[model samples]
Target: MPKLLITGIAGGLGRLVAKMARSRWEVIGVDRDPWPSAPDGVVVHQFDMRKRRFEDVFRTERPEAVVHLAFVRHFRSDPATRHEINVEGTKHLLEHCAEYGVRQLVVVSSSYVYGALANNARYMNEEHPLNASRTFPEIRDLCEVEGLVGTFLWRYPEIATSILRPVNTLGHSVHNAIGNYMKIQMVPTVMGFNPMMQFMHAEDLAEAVNVALEKKVRGVYNVAGPGAVPLKRALEEIGRPYFSIPDTVAHTLINTLFSLGIYRFPPGAIDFIKYPCTISDKRFRQATGFRARHTLAEIFASVAP
Candidate 1:
């Protein structure tokens, strides 16, 4: 079996991907956090990707492929370190991949990169420009990482790089912004704005990654679950009661609470509830014949409090 290295193997989605990939590839895991419950055959190392010891894994193990999942998602702490791990860490990772001759790379990005805009297409394609920072500037590092990976994809076609922009992910283990928001009591909504949303189970996303790696999918593609739903419907499906308010009041209250460490997401996240940022996964589905297996009901069930 070819060797595959998974960064952020301690994470929920990362662990799932590792389990799914282990059958076909000898899996090596890397993360700053420890994974004591790692699968029997997999060897996990605790190493910060931005540090010197991280490169040692590549030099020693020489993985044939890599799944880049190491990122600071919640952005509530040390902004500087978060930037280093997300943006600067990716820079070094790309350099290492090039130097180490890794044959394939799979980067898991978020559909939020498309940005929730009032004028957004019902379903954005890969060609759509990433303008997420226009409102949600907090995730600029994610955009920067994707930009770096996007450039690397073209600059090193021999590497067979693929970037997946998956919709909001929710599961029993993963804690994404959407999941955190929906899990809260009395979730807030922008008045008269019921944006469409796309959600997928973390397991389905893990399978998507497996298919991309298996088929060596190259280029950027959007990944989605079976269907899209209105924000109201999504909240209802998850048994989350949301109260609608004017955008001004909603943003202010959320930001204030966030500053006091009461809210999980930033104020800019209001745009997502106010505007749709759904994406079409036709390109990915066409390229690898990958279909999300989890139903919307299952996806919501995993996030229900």
Candidate 2:
């Protein structure tokens, strides 16, 4: 079997992707977090990707394919630390892939890269500029990482580099910003605005990654779930009640909560609920024939409290 190296294999989404890959490839994983007693055929190395030792994995394992998922997305750590882990860490990984003769690379980016601006299109495409950092500078690391990967895609045409910007991901295990925001008690929203939001089941995302690797897809694409729903409807589907605050005071209020560690999302993210950042997966679906199988109910249940 061909060797496949999966970064962030300790994560829930990583495990799901790894589960789907082990049967087809010799799966090797590297993560700063430990996955004790990993299953057979999946060798998980525990360490930071930025560490000098990471290069050794690429040199020794020489994986033909690579799946990048090692971002510090949950925001549990400090911003400086997250930036180093996400942006700087990915720089090392890309260098390793180019130096180690890897043939394929799949970068799991986010649809949120196209900021939830008031002027955003109904279903933005891959060509849409990434403005996420314009307002939500807190998550600029993600945008920067995507930019780096996109540039690498063009620089190293020899490697089949695929960048998948999946919409908000929801699952029982995987932790995402949207999922975290939805899990809040009395999920807060700015009054007079209920933006259309897109979500994909965790398993569906794992399958998307599988298709990208199996097809050796190159270039950028957006991945979506069954469809879009209003922010209120998503909460209603999950049986979670939400409260609306005046838009005037929403930012300050949310910012205070975030500083106090009571809110999962920061004030900059409040604009998401106010504006639409929904995406079109036409390019991805047309290329890969991948249709998300999970229903809205199934997606909501995964994140239900």
Candidate 3:
């Protein structure tokens, strides 16, 4: 069986991919946190990605393919610290991938890399410039990571590097900004802005990663669910009532809540609800012959209590 190394194996998506990929590949997982138990054909390693010891995993495992999902997504860490983990850590991983002869690299990125701007097209494609930092400064690290990976992708054509920029992924196991926002009993919305949003179930994203590895899909692709929905409709479907507040007032309240430790998301996250960042999955579907097995409703239901 082919060997596969997955970073961020403790995360929801990483764990799912490891479980799903185990039957087909020799799976080795690395994360900053330890897992209680390793899945049936998988081994888990606990260590920070930035440390030199990370290379030890690559040296020993010598994986033919790597799924990079170890990015920091929570607001628990400050921007500088997050940058070290997200940007610097990914740089380290890429350098090791080149040195270790990893043939295929699948990097999990976010649609947030494309800023949620009012002027955004109905469906942003992979070629769209990453302007997420213009509004959400916290995600600047992610954008930088993508840029660095893109440069590496071109610089080394020998490695089949596939970057997946998935939209908001939701599942009971996934704890993310959108998932937390949707679970709120009283959801907050910006006045006069109900953006069109797309969601991909965690399983579908895992399947996409598997496809990228199995097929050696090269180039950047956007992975999204079957369809789009208005942000308000999504909340309504979840049985959450939303109250609209002016942008300034909403930001101030969210900032205060963040300062008080009542909210985990930063104030800049409000832009996701206020503007659309939906992506086109046509390229991904055509290249890999992959379609989302879960419908949009099923995605929401999976996360719903």
Candidate 4:
């Protein structure tokens, strides 16, 4: 079995992926927090990706492939720190990969890079230009991160870079924005506005990452489910009530509540409301011959349970 190194193993999706990968590969995981348990046959290492010394850990492990997932995940709270970890830390990892001759890397990215919203007709293929104007700070940071990773590939064509851009990953992890909303019963289904929603189960993402490792494809690809379900329909399927407040009202209400410190939304949550961002998985399907096995309904059901 080839050795594999996965960052952010302490995260919900990382833990799930480590559990699945350990059965076949010699899985090694790294994260800032100490992993609570080693999940049977895997090795977990603790390290902050933001530090200069993080490269030393990568050098010592020298795994055959890497799956990078560690990130600050929020830009509004602190733009500087978000860039430090998401972009600088990614550069650290890629620098080490290039130095050590690591052949394959699958870095998790987001569809927010595509921008606020386009007409539903746009399939969001891999060729779409990354969103500009710094529309949302979170995506603005991702645009930087993605460009940095792409540059690494450009510099070293021999090394393959696989970018997985998944939209609205719904899974059992409480850390995910949408999943957390569902957990706290805070997600309000808008009746009048039903934006196209695309999601993948956590298990499927892990499996897809594993497949990326095996296929060794080079270039950017969108990894999402087949169909785009409406947000209202998605909430209804999850057994949640739908309330479609008018566009003006919804914005005012959320902004007012947030101003009072009564609640907090994800960094790009509000911008996404109007954009209805959705991505296509056709490129990934053609590259790796992989398809999402679970439906949004099934994944939401698991998360709710």
Candidate 5:
């Protein structure tokens, strides 16, 4: 069986990817922290990419492909380190992958690269240019990661790369992030009037990664849920109430809470709440032949208990 290396196996998405690929591939999971449990065929390595060199691990494993999910999702602790891991870490990973002659590389990226704007309403295709100016620090940093992948793909055509831009993904055992408040019956803060939002199940995203690895599809693809709906409707679908909050008030409260160490938000996470983020997955679906079996209702149903 071909070998596959998955970074950050301690994460929800990383675990899902390992489980999805275990039956077919020899899976090796690398993470800084110890993972609770690994899939049957997975070998978890307690490795920190920040302090340790990953090239040694790559050469030892000699993976046929890689699923890069390691990232700094939060920037509160160390802004410089966040950029180092997300941006520089990616550069390091890509250079090593190219050197080792890895066949395909699957990079998981967020949709925030598009920026927070209503004009991004249309299903954003892979060809769409990322918004260069983003106010949020974390969003700007993530945008750098996306840009790095684009550059990597252009520079190294020999190594096939599939960049998946998934909207809000929720699943059991994973941190729900924005969708969690709705699950608790609290008024989910809406930035403005009804704004359409789309999301995917983490398991589905894992399956899509598997397909990408197997097919070696090169290029960027937007992978979202069935369709887009108003944020209020999404809250209702998940059995939660929605409350409109003024942007000024919300931002003030959010900043205040963070300053007091009461609550913290990723740089761009709040901006996302204020705007609609909808992407077109037509090309992604057609290419991977992937379908989301679980609906928002099913996901919420499992969480309700």
Candidate 6:
């Protein structure tokens, strides 16, 4: 069986992908934390992605494919630490993938890279400019990571590099800013701004990765679920009570709360609730012949209290 290496394998998405890919490949997982119970037939490595020892895993496993998902998403993490992990760690991973002759590299990115702006198109596509850093400096590392991977894809045609930019991913096991925000008893929103948002189930995303590896779908693809829903409607569907506050007051409150460690989302995330950054998955669907099997209601139910 071909060897497959997955970073962040301890994460919900990574574990799901490992389980799905196990039937086809021998799986090796690397993460910063140890798993209480790792998946069957998968080797697990616990360590920092930035450590030079990471390359040793590449030498030992000699994986034919790699799925990179070790990015830090917590707002409380030091910005410098996040950057070192997201950007520099990715750089190291890409370098080692090239050196080790890895045939396929799948990098998971977020739709937030498009930047939530008042003037954004109704449905941004893959060619859309990544302006996320213009407002959210914390995500700058992610944008840079995409850039580095894009350059690597062009410079190294031998490696089938597939980049997936997925929208708000929701699932019972998944822990993300949007999921945490939705699970709150009382959620917050910007006054008079109920932006349209799209969500993808973690299972669908894992399937997309599997398809990419199986089909060698090269280039950037935007992976989205069935449909879009207004922020308020999403809250209502999840049975969460949310009140809107003026944008200025919301920003200030979020900033203060984030600084005090009372809130998990940063102030920059306010724009996501204030504007639409919905993405089109036409390219991804066409390339992999994959469609999300879960409905919007199912997605909402996954995170419901």
Clashes of each: 0, 0, 0, 1, 0, 0
Per-residue lDDT of model 3, residues 102-205, tens digit only = 99999999999998999999899999998899998888889999889999999999999989999889998888878887888888799999999998899999
TM-score to true structure, per model: 0.97, 0.96, 0.96, 0.90, 0.91, 0.98
lDDT-based ranking: 6, 2, 1, 3, 5, 4
lDDT string, candidate 5, 264-305, tens digits: 565346657666667788898889787877786775554543
Tell me the lDDT of candidate 4: 0.75
| lDDT accuracy of residue 243 in candidate 3 | 92
lDDT preference between candidates 1 and 5, better one:
1
Best by lDDT: 6
**Winner on TM-score (2 vs 4):** 2
RMSD of each: 1.3, 1.4, 1.4, 2.4, 2.1, 1.1
Using TM-score as the measure, name the better of candidate 4 and candidate 5.
5
What is candidate 6's CA lDDT for residue 23? 97
Question: What lDDT tens digits, residue by residue, belong to model 4 across residues 55-147?
Answer: 776677778888898876643455577777788888888888988768888898877688765453356787877763355554577788888
Better of 4 and 6 by lDDT: 6
| The 10-residue segment with the lowest total lDDT in model 3 | 34-43
Q: For candidate 1, lDDT tens digit of each residue in 27-105?
A: 9999989999898999999877877888999999999999999888886777788888889989999999999999999
Which residue pairs does candidate 2 place in steric collision?
Answer: none
So what's the TM-score on candidate 6? 0.98
| Tens-digit per-residue lDDT, 1-305, candidate 6 | 99999999999999889999999999999999887788678999999888877999999889999999999987778778888889999999999999998999999999999999999998999999998999887788889999999999999998999899999999988998889889888997889999999998999889989999999989999999989999999999989999889988988888898888886677888889999999999999999899999999999999989
lDDT of each: 0.90, 0.91, 0.90, 0.75, 0.77, 0.91
Error in Å for residue 35 of model 6:
1.7
| Residue 263 accuracy (lDDT) in model 4 | 61
**TM-score, predicted candidate 4 vs. hidden true structure:** 0.90
In candidate 3, stretches whose alpha carbon ends up further than 4 angstroms from where it belongs are: 256-264
Q: What tens digits encode model 2's per-residue C-alpha lDDT throughout 132-245?
A: 989898888988998899899999988999999999899998977788888888888789999889989999999999999998899999999999999999999998899988
The 10-residue segment with the lowest total lDDT in model 5? 176-185
